[model samples]
Target: MARSGKDTDKRIKTGRGRTASQIRWLERQLNDPYVKQAKADRYRSRAAYKLIELDEKFGLLQNASRVVDLGIAPGGWAQVVRKKRPKAGIVGIDLLEVEPIEGVTILQMDFMDDAAPDALTEALDGPPDLVLSDMAANTVGHKQTDHLRTMGLVETAVDFAVQTLEPGGAFVAKVLAGGTDNELLKLLKANFTSVKHAKPPASRKGSSEWYVVAKGFKGRD
Candidate 1:
C-alpha cells in the first residue's frame, strides 16, 4: 500500500518495465499530503481538495442548486460537490468512465459532441447555478499545440455556461499558466459581472494550471 505523508521520503527500487518518469510520479504521489487526506476522507482523488480549496475561497457551492461538471473522470470534483451540497442536482460528463456516485448522474460521452449540451440540460430540473469544467485536451507534447487544444475546451465550456447558466450563476474552469487568453477574457467579462483567476493551493506549485472564476451571469439577452 502507498502512504501519502511528507514525514519521510519514500523511494522505490528501479523495477523492470518501470520508466524513470513513472517512478518519479509514484514517489510524488506517495509524498502528497492531499492524497493521504483524500484517502482518509474517502474522497475520490487528490483533485477533490482542489475543489474544496476553491470552494472555501470562492463559495462556489454555497447557493448552487444545479451543477454541471465537465471532465468528471475519477469523480473527484463531483464528490466534493456532493459532500458540500447534498441536495444540489449534479450532472457530469467525460470521455472516461466514472464509478457510480450516489447522487450524481454520470454521462460517458464526449462533451464536444453536439448532443452533449442538450443531454446535460435535460438531466437537470432547471438551469444550473454552477457550471464547473476541469477539462483539458490530451497533450501532444508540443507546447503551443497543447495550449491551443486545452483552450479550445475551455472556450466550449464558457459557451455552455453562458448559454445555460441561471442569472447569478457562476462558472469555474481550469486554464493554463497564463490564464485565459484575451478574447476569452473579454467574452467572460462581457457576460459576467465578476471574472478573476486563481491557482488553488492544492494544485502543485510546478503545475501550470490556474482557474478562471466568472460569477453573476448577465443572461443571454
Candidate 2:
C-alpha cells in the first residue's frame, strides 16, 4: 500500500495467508495516533481516551463513591476510574477475563446473567453514583442483526442503571450512530434530568458508535 504523503506513516507488510482486511486493520492500528499515545501512557487500550474525553466533558467521575462498569473487558475503563477516583469502589463484569486491576473488583461472567446485578451491587458498599457501560454485542456480519444485538445490550444496561443508580447519579453507555431508538430515548428522558448523545474525538470517524449520557437519576417512584 502506498503512503498518503505522510513521512511518519507506518506500513504493514502483508505476509502469506494474511487477509486484506487483516492487513488494513494492522496498517490502521500502526498509523493511529491514539494507539501510540496509549502505549506511551501505559493504558491497556486506546478506548481509555474515549472515557477520558467523556469524563472531561461531563464531569462524570467527580466525587463518585461507587461505580459499576458493564462489559469492562481488558480493564481499560476500570483503570481510568481507579486513576481518577482512587478511593471509589469499582466493580466490573465481563465475559472475558480481565487481568486484575488494583482497587477494582472483577467478575469474569456474563453481565446478562440474572444474578449479575446482585453480585455487582454486593461488591459495592452503596448504590453506584456512576454507571458506565461500554458493552456492545459481538458483530455477526449482518448489519441489522449487529445493530439490534448491540441495542439490546444498551437497553438492558439502561434498565439496570434505572433500578440501581443513586439519586443525582449519572449513566453513560455506548449507543449506535442513529442514537438510541425512540423507545429507549423516551425511557431515558423520563428517568433522567438530562439525556444527550456524544461522540468523543477518540472515537474513530469511520465508527458508528455514539455515547448516550444520562444524568441526574430519578429515584424509583
Candidate 3:
C-alpha cells in the first residue's frame, strides 16, 4: 500500500510546553471544514465521510439492499448506510452497545469470535448485498501491536464475508497503512473481482488507517 500525508494545518501559535504533534492534530481538526460540516449535519464522527466517499466512488449500495455492519460502535458508518438507502436492511453488531435506530437492528456482540458470523447470518432473512466493517483497535501506542491487532480484525471479517456474501457482493474494512499480513492479501486477491486499498478523504490526515474494498466476490461457499 502507498503512504500519503496531507499538508499539516496550523503552525505553533500557543500552548508553549505542549507537544507540537498533539497541538497540530487538534488544530487541523478544528480548522477542517468537513469537521464543522459533520457536526452541523449531526454525524456521529467525521469518519462517516469515508463511507460517503466510498459510496460516491463505487456505487456500493442499491435500493432495498441487505447489509451487515461489524464494529458498529457510535453508529457513524451505519448511519451513512441508512441515509443512502433509506429502504435498505441493516444489521449491525459491535462489542460496544449502540443506541437503536428505527431502521437498523443492532446486536451487541464481539464479532472477532468464531460464532459471530453465524449470529449475524441468523439475523438475516436472506444473503447480504454488502458487508461493511469499520473496526479498528484503539492504539496501545505500540506500532507493531496495533498493526497486528487491526490486521486480525480485517482477516476475520474477510473470512466471514467469504461465507456469507452473495455473489457480486462487496466487502469493505479498515486497515492501517503498514504491516498488513501478505497471506491475507493473497486470499483477498483470489476471491475478489478487484481488491483496492484506498484512503477516503474523510479519514483524518494523521490517521494511520485506510480502507480496503474487495468487490465482486465469486462465493467460495
In order of appearance, the predictions have TM-scores of: 0.96, 0.96, 0.85
TM-score (C-alpha) between model 3 and the true structure: 0.85
lDDT of 1 by residue, 158-212 (tens): 9999999999999999999899999999999999999999999889999999999
lDDT of 1 at 139: 90
Better model by lDDT, 1 or 3?
1
lDDT by residue for model 2 (73-97), tens: 9888999999999999999999999
**Please, what is the whole-model Cα lDDT of each candidate in the order they appear?**
0.93, 0.92, 0.83
Model 2: residues with Cα > 4 Å off, grouped in runs = 1-7
Model 3, C-alpha of 145: deviation from truth (Å): 1.1
Q: After superposition, how far is residue 28 of candidate 1 from its true place, in Å?
A: 0.4
The per-residue C-alpha lDDT of model 1 at residue 2 equals 45
Cα lDDT of candidate 1 equals 0.93
Per-candidate RMSD, Å: 2.4, 3.2, 4.7
Q: What TM-score would you give candidate 2 relative to the actual structure? A: 0.96
